[model samples]
Target: MWKITYSIVGYDPVEKEWGVATQSKFLAVGAVVPFAVAGVGAVATQSYANTSYGPEGMEHMSSGKSAQETIDLLTSIDEDRALRQVGMIDGQGNAATYTGEKCYDWAGGITGKHYAVQGNILIAGTVEAMAKTFEETEGTLADRLLASLAAGQQAGGDSRGQQSAALLVVKKAGGYGGFSDRFIDLRVDDHKTPVDELIRIHRIHQLYFSKSKKDRIVPIEEQIAETLDHQLTRLGYKKEDQPLLHTFKDYLHTENFEMRAQEDGFIDLDVLEHMTRS
Candidate 1:
């Protein structure tokens, strides 16, 4: 029996996104909890987790079931329903949760308009703190979700302690190079402070992977070339007859900044900042 103490699964109507953030004393709680699919919904199955709840629950939601309907149908069929705990939020912003009668002390979940928060073997305030944070935080869905997780931790997370943490968020074709919906999938499999570790890992991922704002784009100018040349030279680049502009362009591609750069000679200011900052 797994003991995943806390999780939040929610939908963002503005971005048409779904995400789950979870932390636990159990090793690799990320693997046992979050399950989601783009244009479908998000689910976190915990307590004595029934892994099947993920795929099957998503199947029902994708086929037009409301969040409550999906939860009802799925749990009703589980002979061990009383041993399971689940939280779900569907594509249309409907939310529902079920905490089985037989779940451990402090095991329960609460649903808001477009989100659900749940926990087992947690401090009494953990799940409630998560819900409050999600509602009050600003920025993108990912940012809000992370804030909720942090708040949950601040309010005293899993009573047993911490070991692993994970974050998963999905959007249509939002993955690397637009090939998949997995916009973010990060895990701290083992750590003395998994939440803090996961947050640091996420920042690095965002620097390299997240989309750059259009306003940050700047045309290649002589000053820009000089900046690149100065920074690159410090990093052992030699001034060649080859233009530093082309050299910087090559560097951008090498560093996977293709999404924010155009060989036509315009680049995102963040790229330049990245070059100088790094």
Candidate 2:
């Protein structure tokens, strides 16, 4: 009487490789639902929390197993034949997913060239809808994964109602400083709209946390000094009493510019916008 929905997209531009995987459960499941290895372009998504497949599947992919081969190996190894569902994608774009007969109602998946989407115990006919929406959506692999999550939400995600949602994407040199995973790694443990909130957080990540495209240092030029003076004056620091402004500037330069004039109990920038009219 529960459903879990998830998706992953892994792209490595240098290798020209891409892979996608997804699975779901009733709670804020972690690597249990989906896992990806950056260098290999492989993903393992197991439902009913068949975690053994995660590492084992990666092993197969590392040894050059195609997605289908890895899935077959996992399904074949599970002694309790009717108690597992798994999906995998490999570097070569091959894909596969499995739904054991013993799984709860309305559990299945669809595999595509570069992606495989799956869910279990979802409301009505959500699994097919989720898969169809994922395949139809266009954009970066990350966008397609997000679209899959959106589709799951639209099709009545998690029959028990929303609690948490997560997204994980991987690629080589993706992480900050070229160190770790580069794409979305967001989680909403409990919310009225977990997926929506996840998307908002993802946007925030894109803005400030991803990578600095522009140099952040403000040049100490005359025009910039004038702007700083204007900002200080609007805060009620008169030009004659601007001796305090010199001290503030000294503090700014001395402290690595960590001190902003606005934070010194002066005019708030938000208020400054209104002060222009006043």
Candidate 3:
């Protein structure tokens, strides 16, 4: 019954995705707080949390319930409902949140068209900051989610301090190898600056997993080839008789940038920048 945290559950209608981003003084807050399903909804349950609320809430939404109906059903049957706080966004962009009366001081939540922001054991204005940022920020769902989390922390985050954070987003056939719904799932299990660390790791994740735009690909022109050759040599690879493209392909494979690699002699612009930085 010691759960204390702040979180946002959001839906991106343009991408048809649902996600949750949360930070807490509690250890591995990601593991306990965020839950999402592609084509279903997302949930964040905290503050003397009932873990069952996550999966159960999704089940209710999947069974044709709205976000408010799902939350109502969950709180109605729980004997200790007054101790729980939860936020949710259904697939249709309906959002709902509930903060039990008995939750710690400065506890409450706000819901909007496609988001629910909530927290407990926090300084005043945390949820308000989160809601404002989410509404004003423009980018991908992950971008908005992370921005909102940072805003919450800046406004006065968990009174107990921050320890761990997590980001979870799901899309149809978005997982690795296109085999699952886990588009992006990252966690900072324990860190002094968990939100910042999470952001750093997410950048790495995007570089390695995100699809490259066709327009960003450039052919290995004379100057670009020389730069690539020089960089590759510094990494301990000697120029060989094989075509420069072959050598570059080998380097891409070794560095796990194969997803961004192109056939012929073209290279993704971001991948090239990463190579030069390395």
2 or 3, greater by TM-score = 3
Whole-model lDDT, model 1: 0.86
Q: Please, what are the lDDT tens digits per residue for candidate 2 over residues 65-120?
A: 88788878878877864767666777666677777888776667777656676666
How far in Å is the alpha carbon of 108 misplaced in model 1? 1.8
Stretches of candidate 2 exceeding 4 Å from the true structure: 1-25, 211-278
Which should have the higher lDDT, number 2 or number 3?
3
lDDT at position 34, candidate 1: 91
Task: List clashing residue pairs in candidate 2.
Answer: 4-24, 4-25, 174-182, 175-180
Instruction: Note the Cα lDDT for every prediction shown.
Output: 0.86, 0.60, 0.92
Q: Assess candidate 3 and give its TM-score to the true structure.
A: 0.95
Q: How does each model score on TM-score?
A: 0.88, 0.70, 0.95
Question: lDDT by residue for model 3 over 87-150, one digit each (tens)?
Answer: 9999898999999999998999999879999999999999999999999999999999999999
Error of 3 at 75 (Å): 0.8
TM-score for candidate 2, residues paired by index:
0.70
